[model samples]
Target: MGHTTGGPDSAKRRLRRELLAVRNALPADDLREAAAALARHALDLPELAGASTVAAYVSVGGEPGTLALLEALRARGVRVLLPALLPDDDLDWGAYEGEGSLARVRHGGRMALFEPSGERLGPDAVTDADVVLLPGLAVDARGMRLGRGGGSYDRVLARLARSGSRASLVVLLYDGEVVERVPEEPHDAPVHAVVTPSGVRRFS
Candidate 1:
C-alpha cells in the first residue's frame, strides 16, 4: 500500500481492480517484452545512476519484471535493498547480493516471493536509501500511486516520512499504467517520478 487504500481509499479500490485486470490480461510474450523495455527505460534514470542505495522489490505475477534492472544495479556496485513482508504487513529490509542471495518465501494467501536471505537490516533500513522503487497498479499526473491494497508499502512510506528521509520515491509500471488522475488522501504522498516501458515521467 504505497500511501494507498485507507484514507479516501474506496475510489482507489475500484480503480485498482480495473487496472489490475488490464495488466493481468497481457499475453505472456507481451509481458516479457514489456519487462525488457521497462528495464531499459528504468536503468537510464538519473536518480538510479548515482544512487548508493535503492529500496526495491521483486516483480511477481503480471507485474513488470525488475530482475534485469536489479542485476544491472548490483553490477554497478550499488546497494540494493529488497523487502521481506512481515506478518503485520510492514516490511523489513535486506541487502540484495545477487540471484543466489535470494530465498523463496510464501506467506499465507500470497504468492511465493523471492527475498534476500542473508540478514535482516530492520525496517528502518529503507530510510537510508537514496531512492525507493515502489510497486503500483497505476500512477497519476499528480504522482499519486495506487498500490495492491496490502498497505505494506504504505507503512514503508509512513516510516520514511516519520524519519524525514530524503529518498527519491519512484514507481515502476507498464506503459499504460500511467494515468490522468488517481484518488488521493491525507496519508498519500506524491511520488517523485514513474518509470514505464515507454519512458520516465517526473512530478514536482
Candidate 2:
C-alpha cells in the first residue's frame, strides 16, 4: 500500500479535525456572544471601515458567526456580497439583503448553508469587493488560514489574482483558533489579517 497520511495535506486534515472538535464543543451561548464580539472587532478594522463593498460568507454550524458582521456592514451602506456555492465548488455572488434574504441550502451531502436568495451576481462580482472576509477553522502566526477544504475560496483567490484585485483578505475565527502554525501548501496564500472574538491580528 502507498503512504497517504503524511505531508502538509494530511497535517491540514488532522489540524482541521482537531479545531472543529473544539469548536463543536463550544456552548451555544458562548458562540452567540463570540459572534457579537467578532463583529465588533471586525468592524473596527480599517480594511472594512471605508470599504464600499465586502465579499463575505454566512457561517454555518460551529464556524465563527458572521451574520452580525454582515448586518452591520449592510447598515453602514456597504454593499455586502454573499457566496452561493456552485455545483463545481466555485462560488457565485449575490447581494445580502438581510436575515430574510438568506435561504438555507444543502450542497450534496454537505451541511446546510445559509446563502443569499436574491439574483446571482456571478463569480466575477467578488473582484469588486474592497475586502473579502473568509471563514476559516484556524489561522497560524504567519497568517495562513485553514479553510473547510471546499476549494471554493481557493478559486476565489485565484480569480482575485487573475483580475488584479487589491481587496484586503481577512479571516474570521475564534481566539483559540489562532495557533502557532498551520500546514501550508505551495498554492496557499497568506491573508492580510484575522479577526477573532478577542481582537484582530494583522500580517505584513
Candidate 3:
C-alpha cells in the first residue's frame, strides 16, 4: 500500500522543505550561469525557434532567470502569453508585449501584469500554445514536476492531453534541483523537457 493518508497540509510542508534544501545546496554563481545557458538552449530549440506564440509563467522566489528569458523572447518578436491567476481555479492568458506594456491586475493579495487585448480563456487555451514553460520547485529525470502543491498546471496539461494538443511542456529548474526521481501522484503531469542553465534535458 502507498502512503496516501497524509493531508494536503502535510504534503505541502514536506514539499516546501525539500525545495528549500535544494535551493540552499546550489552554488549561487553556478545557479545563475546555468539559468542563462538553459535559456539560450531553450531559445535555440527547433520547436521554439520562430514560434509565434508561447506560454510562460511569472517567476517568483529563486526563479529569477525566467525574467531574462522572457525579455529575450520578446526581443525576438515571439508573442508571449503569461498566466493571469483568477478565482474559481481558472486562468487567463495575457500577452506580454514588453515591460512597458504590462498593466496591473489584481489577483488575491498580489498584482500581475497583463495586456489590455489579452484573451481571457480557460484551460483549453493550452492547446493554442506552441510551447509552455512551467515553473517548479524540483523536477526529475523523467520530467515529473514538483510544484507548490497547486494543481493549476496539471489541470491545464490534462485538458491538453484530452484534446490531443501538441504543445511542449518545458519545466525550468536550477541544476541542483534536478533529481533522479520525485514523489509523484497519479494526477501529476509529466513535462516533455526539463531545462536548467546547463542544457535542455529530454526525459525518457
Which lDDT tens digits does candidate 1 get at residues 8-101?
A: 5688888888998998798999988888898888889999997999999989889999988899899999999999999998999999999899
Identify the superior model by lDDT, candidate 1 or candidate 2. Answer: 2
lDDT, model 1, position 122:
97
Looking at model 2, residue 50 earns an lDDT score of 91
* Tens-digit per-residue lDDT, 23-72, candidate 3: 76667686677667877878877778857888887665456367678888
Best by TM-score: 2
Tens digit of per-residue lDDT, candidate 2, span 97-202:
9999999999999999999999999999999999999988898999998988889999999999999999999999998989999999999999999999999999
**Can you give the lDDT of residue 183 in candidate 1?**
84
| Error at 161, model 1, angstroms | 1.2
In model 1, which runs have C-alpha deviations exceeding 4 angstroms?
1-7
| Cα lDDT listed for each candidate | 0.91, 0.94, 0.73
Task: Determine which window of 10 residues in candidate 2 has minimal summed lDDT.
Answer: 1-10
TM-score of each model, in listed order: 0.94, 0.97, 0.80
lDDT of 1: 0.91
